[model samples]
Target chain A: MKSEARKPFSKDIIHIENIDQVCNDIIAKLKMDVTKNLQRRGAIVGISGGIDSSVCLALSAKAFGSKNVLGIMLPEQDSSDDSRHLAEKLAATYGVSTLIEDITKALDGFGCYERRDEAILRVIPDFDKKVDKAKIEIKQNIAENIPAIFSITVIKPNGDVVSKLLPAREYLQIVASTNFKQRSRMSMLYYHAERMHYAVIGTPNKHEVEQGFFVKYGDGGADVMPIGHFYKTQVYQLAKHLGVPQEIIDRTPTTDTYTAEQSQEDFFYQMPFESMDLIWYGWENNYPAEEVGKVMGKTTKEIENIYKSFERKRKTTEYLRMKPIF
Target chain B: MKSKNDVKTEIKKYILEASLSDVKDVEDDALIFENGLLDSMGLLFLIEFLGETFEVEVNDDELNPKNFESINNIVSFVNNKLSVKV
Candidate 1:
C-alpha cells in the first residue's frame, strides 16, 4: 500500500470543505447508531441554544425526521433567558417539538445553590447569594508555563466586584455543587428518552470530550454522541450547513452553569476555540512546535507550553472518560 | 523555620494521603504528576498545604509545574521563597 501524504499544518487544518457530504455521513451514522445499534425509535436532544447542541438537534431532525425528534430545554435559575429563547427559536426552525423542564426546583431540592453559596462564602465572607453573582475562572493564559490557578469572582448588586484566589477545599465544593446542574439535566434527558423510546443525543465537541470539560455521568452520559468527533470550529461549519439559527451561530458559547455570565473560554479551554482548534490539530498531528508557532504568530516555547497544558488536562481528566470496572 | 528535610517529609505525606494510593516508595526526585501519584485536584490541595504549613505565599507566577514536579524541586522552591522572606 502506498503511504498517504500528510497535509501541512495551518489555520485551515480543521475546516470542513464539503459540509453537505459531512452532514449526510453524520445523519447516516446517527440513524444506524440509534435505530440499528440501540433499537431506539428517535432522538431526544437537550438543546441549550448553544452551537453544539443546536447542530446536534438539527442533525437529529434530519436523521430521525423532525416529527420523530424531541428537543428538551432544561433550564435552572442561573440559566440565561436568552438560552431558552434561542432554544425555542431553534426548535421552531427545525419543526421539532420541545418540552420546557424547569430544573430550578430540582436543583433547589438538591441544595445546589445553598451548597455552592456556602463554598463561595468561604472565599468571600460577605458574598450574598440573593443579590450577588459569582463565577470561577483561570487566572492566567494556558500558553504560559504556569499551573492553572482558579479564582472566584463576585459582583455585588451595586456594581462592586470582588475577586480572590479560591482555596482548594472551597473550589472543590463549589465545583461539586455546580455539577448538579449537568447531572440533573442528564437525568431529565434520560427520562424523556426512555419514556419516548428515543436515544439521548450528546452535544459535546472534540475539545469538550478530549479535554474532559464535561461532568462524568452527567453530560457525559449519552445514548449516542453524533458530533463528538468534530472540533468546535467544525461544529460551527456544520451549524451553518444545517441551517441552524443565525443568532445561535453568532452567539458566544457560555457555560451557563455560573450565576455570572461567563464565556466557555473563560470557564475552561483558557483560549478562543479558533486558536485552540488549530493548535490542537497541529499538536495531535505531530507537527513541529516551530511550524505551528509560525502560523499562530506565537513563539515555539509558547506552543510547547500550550501542548503541555493540553496534555496535563487530558491526563488529569482521564478518569471522567473511564467506564465501570468489575 | 522548617528545614528542607521537613518540607520533603510533609509533601510526601500529603501526596500519599491525597492520592490515596498504596505506593510506599516515593523517591526524592520522583515525578509525582507524571507518575500518576497525584492529579490536578491533588496539586491544588498540595499548594494550599504548602502555603499554610510553611507560612509562605505561593504567588500566581510561582505556580509552575517545574517547581513542583518532584520532591527535590518543591523543597528548593520552598527554600527559595523562605530565603526571599528572610
Candidate 2:
C-alpha cells in the first residue's frame, strides 16, 4: 500500500500573523458586534484575573473606550483569595471601571455548596463538608469505544484520600450544583447589563469552548464572545502584546470552581494545554495518530486514545453549543 | 391567553431556539439531560421560558431535573401550574 502525502501543518500559524493586527481585528469586530448589531452602548465583563478575561477586558477597553467597559469581579466563597486582588489590579492597569460583586449570598440562596457536598458524600462517604476536598483524574476508555467512565478522588483531613468511579446520577448532581457559580454570575451580569443597557462579554477561548470546558448559561452565557476563535496559546500572545500585567499572564490557568487549588489541566484536558492544542489541531486536520504521537513523543496508541477522548468530549458536550429547543 | 397545547408549543420553540443539537425529532418521553440534549443552564432557560410565556412563577423548590427532563414532563408541569392557579 502506498503512503498518503501529508499536508503541511505549520505550527507558526498558531503564533498567528502579526499579533497586533489580530488584536486590532478583534477590537474592530467587538465594536461592530455591540454598536451595530446589539445596539448596546458598552460591555460588561466578569474578570477572573485569568489570561482569557484579562485579554478580553483589554480588548474591550480598546474597542469601546476604557470608560465604556465595566470590569466586574465576581468572587464566590470557593474563589481563591488572590483572584479578587489580581482582577482589581488588572482593571486598574487597564483604566477600566471596576465593581466588586461578592456572589456568596446568591450562591447560598441556590444551595450551591449544599447540593455539591451531597454529591461528594456519595463518592466519599467519610468526607467532611468543613474540610476542603477535591475531585480529579477522570479516566476514560476512549479506545475501548465505551461510554466514558468518570472517576473522582477526594482529599481528606488526615491526608488520606478516597477514589471511586462515579455513577451517572451522582456525577451529574455534583456538576449541576457546581454550575450554579457560572449561572449566578451570568444572571448578575445580565442585571447590570439590563440596567445600564450594556452587553455581557464572555472570555472562553477556542479550546475551552470546543472541548466543553464551560458550563452552559453559566460562564458560557454571553452577549458577545470576543476571543472564542483563538486558541489558549494564541490568547497568551495577545495578552503579552496588549501589555497585560506579567503576574497575571505568568499565573497558571485554574478552574477556581472547587475549594482546593485545581489547575485547568486537572479539571479538564488529559494533557497540558500546549500538547492538547497541537494534537487537537492535527487530529482535526486528519493527521495520522502515529505521526502526531511522534511529534508529541508519545506512542501511537496513546495519541489515538487522546484523540478519541477529544472526540468523545466534543460529542457529549454538543448541547452547550445549542440555542434552545425551538 | 394561550391554551395548554399553545404553552407546550411555545416551550418547544424556545428549546429549539436555545439548543444547537439535533433534538428536533426526539421523542416526547426522551430523557433530555441524561442524553446530553440539555444541561443545567439549558434547564434554567427552559424554566424562565415557561415562566414568561405561560405567566407562571417557578419557585426555587420546583427546579428539579425531572420536571424539565422531557417535553411530556414540561407539559404536565405547565398544566398542573395552570390548574393550581384556576
Top candidate (lDDT): 1
DockQ score of the complex predicted as candidate 1 = 0.42
Steric clashes per prediction: 0, 18
lDDT of 1 by residue, A1-326 (tens): 12147777778878998889999999999999999999999999999999999999999999999999999999989999999999999999999999999999999999999999999998899999899999998877797654576889999999999988778889989999999999999999999998999999999999999999999989999988899999999999998889998999999999999999899999888999999999998887788899999999999999998987888888878889999988
Question: All models: lDDT?
Answer: 0.88, 0.79
lDDT of 2 by residue, A1-326 (tens): 22366545545536676887888999999999999999999999999989999999999999999999999999998899888889989999889999999999999999999998888887678778888577655453233322344456777777786766554566778889989999999999999988889999999999879988898999999999999988888898899999899999999899888876778876676567787788888777778888777777878887776776677678768989888997
Q: In terms of docking quality, how is candidate 2 classified?
A: incorrect
DockQ for candidate 2, C-alpha atoms: 0.02
- Candidate 2 segments exceeding 4 Å error: A1-7, A10-13, A139-148, B1-86
Looking only at chain B, model 2 earns a TM-score of 0.82
